[model samples]
Target: MIGFKLLHEKNHSSATHKGTGAWFGSKPINVDIGQNPVFLLRAPDGSVGAAISSNDSANAYKQALITLVKNTLDRFSRGGFSAASLEAAMLGGAENARWKWDRMLEIVRNDFTNIKKFDEGGLYYRIIHFDPKSGLAAVSRKKANPDDWNPASAKLSIESGTKGFSEGHAGGVVANATRFFREKTTFTALREVVIPAHLAETPDAPFLFWSAACSAGAEAYSYAMYIHRLLTRAKATCPFKVFATDINQKLVEGAKTGVYKANKNDIGEYRAYFRRYGELDGDTVRFGKEIRQFISFNTFDLKQRPRKKGFRMVVCANVFQYYDDAARSHFLENFMSAVTRPGYIFVGPMRDPIIHALGLKKLTKYKMFMVE
Candidate 1:
């Protein structure tokens, strides 16, 4: 009897070449982001094959060339070319197709790395890197603007066990607020909304605060702190009410638990205010009696119809970017329908156009606008 290891078995594979001498074999390619570009090849039976990507621009060009080779494989599979004849045709054609050959080679040599596996919509997808300077190729992948505030980044940090209400998080919020304020000013042809002067004056004035997408409770807690400070200073007779909602059940439970790390450095000058108004229980920070009394956190989807009526101010920031244009329009309509007349609506920077289209009167100073 002959003993054979399963790993030693070879699987049947096919190869094809484009018209520019680049060739591809039947294999799964994986792409991901890293300090350098990376590509991984898997055999037809999903065994490891080869990997590539390096610092040199030539590596990027080679990656691009491989992509073209893959395209040729797809074309050949579609009956456009015979796999057996592909290599000869491509090598011969490369002489006359110098531009295609050079372009393919340049792309493969310059802009590729970080190969990883991704599963999306029941299909596997690979992440690939391209040089943004390479024009349309680079633009194909969404790249973050280094200077722009990304709420998504902040959320990721919070989810990764970082303190959510820290100065870093607050700074992200402030940056988002500033950007939204600027965009609102330009879109509405009005002045920017400043942090409400009233916030400093009267925090306990029955505040009807609405946090539309209060994911994981960071935003709600931040607002609670803001209100707590205001009310403490005012020695106000009346209390405020915060209506915080999110689509995520897990985050809603977390918010209700009110547990968070006490990071004084992250909260900044608000540390004093938090100490005065927040109660610490283990790693969780609960809003002080005064602030807690006013906040009602719930699980609600912004895309759905509003359940409550008569909100004075609605903060829907960071929700719009998650939605498509049509969904955004529908959401805005629902939002306007839910709030009381003369109520304020605050959105993130990117939703200015959608906000304006809803026919709301833009307010100055706080990145807030009136929908009355």
Candidate 2:
């Protein structure tokens, strides 16, 4: 929970730290004709973050950045890493020193391509804070605090039901890169191994599946269609449901409608199944009551305990690759608690090695972890 405040005026300064401990660059101090813009950088995997309270001169900015880069690699314990390998963001320069910021920004642009800037004309008083563990860089002109933050809870920058884009955390839910049937290989594995075992074990028992981080209910509906077809073919009298949850309320509401627009190309191999589950009109697909009945969509965060448990399989197909070692372990432990003894956890194709490190047996073919 320790935090450092950076205020650069006459000289350049830098700070780098481990998880949860934050580095913040407050409003720029005006000592000379030019003011320093706060520079921030983080590794691609969200492992380490470095912040530089930059000097107005381009050479000072460049030197401070390069030193911070080496220090960041040391923190990551990676021998081969540079600022070019990091995501960058810069914020808050003096309004009159906008011209000086141009050269310093150019120096930063040479090192980072995936960058965010808030040093514009009106953002002069803006305060920027970054938590590397959560990959949160909150920026606002209003009084903001990063010290009183819990990495597990996103309550610092935004309240749960707030409207508009979430500043630092995962962009915004509206622009989610999720659709029906993302991570095709993971779904294939779900059918081949997990489904059959669940059906055979208790032919007449209620079957349950939980889709964590289900953006817009792509995987949730896809699971419903697949299970519905399976139950029909097997002719087994078993009650079943898929519980889909996301942290964003807006996305969960949109998913409840079960209306997706996907063409033949986007539908790909699941086109026929898509037709079976919903009323299809060209590219507009409406999943009516038939498919919608099997899924219960709600706004739920993985960090919180589920009200219901005993999920046969918990498919958290994405989001792990963005987390660091400690974060991945924390989430995985929470996931384990909500699953059955003989259950499985699907963590997608970009698999986390910690799955095996935690000694959860791997269903290697499907790239999932067995709880037992």
Candidate 3:
């Protein structure tokens, strides 16, 4: 590993890279970030994997970084050449005016030694070194086998047993809007598919919706906004509850506050989203009383079964890809069992294949699923 000294200055800009060739214990890969660094490690034999990010709020970046690595390796087998080489190639003749690459790497190295715990999808990262300040985080197998990180010889969760909320930060409201929950499309789907499906089965019961692993309540709030719109448009008086749960208590609290400190871009074109469901009060955006009242935030673990079930629709997005096949099945089973018969599960685009593999049917019209 390269070594350096830390500079006191801070660079507000974000830098990201994707490629291959950086190896951490025989795993070939490429990914580098400045400002907010993310490191994902997988055992050579492929029995274990670890994902570390600078902040709990960098959820999208961490997920994207890991997904890119997995997809790259899966496609080319070797991924794309060495990450170091890729960095040089990208710079070409460019100058590092604002960002200090050496300073970033140095901070990452020094701060990584401080991490003591890790959490993902409610599982442990074995707790290695995680410096939230320097954005340098690393997690290794708690018990390493002489050869592969074979699960037979080692369990991944034997560290300090401290839970981490790093996985809770997905993105802001606009980020959620343009990417996952498009207001127009999502509303159409809810009205045309999810609502009617639930109505048919439980005509007299109040509709129930769950946002599993909901980070910072953005997705849940967005859903509330649209669910409000859908009901208003349809002239339906059915009562509904948007249950938003996350393993990260901090994020759940933030979600419960119904405040999002989104960026200028996040609050710009998507003004209506904030205006209708939430309000921009100075730097922080607060969800209106109407939408906030409908959501109940809980620091719930996904690994455990819910005390209650029978949700009309459940949304668990951007989380499935992190788990191994068996773990994925476990979570899928839990989710499917939680919903009403003929219920729907809304997952991200990356998780579509896993849903199919688990033998669940997809609502092709909206990229959601119907658990059979």
Ranking by TM-score: 2, 3, 1
Clash count for candidate 1 is 40
lDDT of 3 by residue, 135-239 (tens): 333323222221222111122121211122242212211212222253244556787988877667665788888988886777788788778777777667788
Clashes of each: 40, 0, 3
Residue 73 in model 3: lDDT:
38
- Residue-level lDDT tens digits of model 1 in 1-372: 101111111221221211122223344322221112232232323222233332222213346556644664455556444333222111101111122233433444332232222211110111332211211111012222223232322222112212332233421343222111122232232112212423443434455667777766666666666655555665655566678887666667867766666554545534555566676554446666665676778977665788787665677765453233455577667778877655667664323465677887766455566775
lDDT of each: 0.43, 0.59, 0.50
In terms of lDDT, the poorest run of 10 residues in model 3 is: 89-98
> Which is the winner by TM-score between candidate 1 and candidate 3?
3
- Model 1, position 368, has a per-residue lDDT of 62
Ranking by lDDT: 2, 3, 1
| Global CA lDDT computed for model 1 | 0.43
Report the error of model 2 at residue 41, Å. 26
Model 3 compared with the native: what TM-score? Answer: 0.54
Question: What lDDT tens digits, residue by residue, belong to model 2 across residues 1-372?
Answer: 112344432233222222212242223222211123566666666656656553312223356655654455465446345656666776655432243345457666765676677544421334445665555555433221222121212221223312222232432223245767766655776568776887778777788888887877878998888877777887868889999988778888989988888857767767787778777787878898888889999887666667788888888864553333454566678778888768888764322356667778877677678898
Which residue pairs collide in model 3, if any? 20-83, 115-129, 115-130
Candidate 2 runs further than 4 Å off = 1-175, 349-353
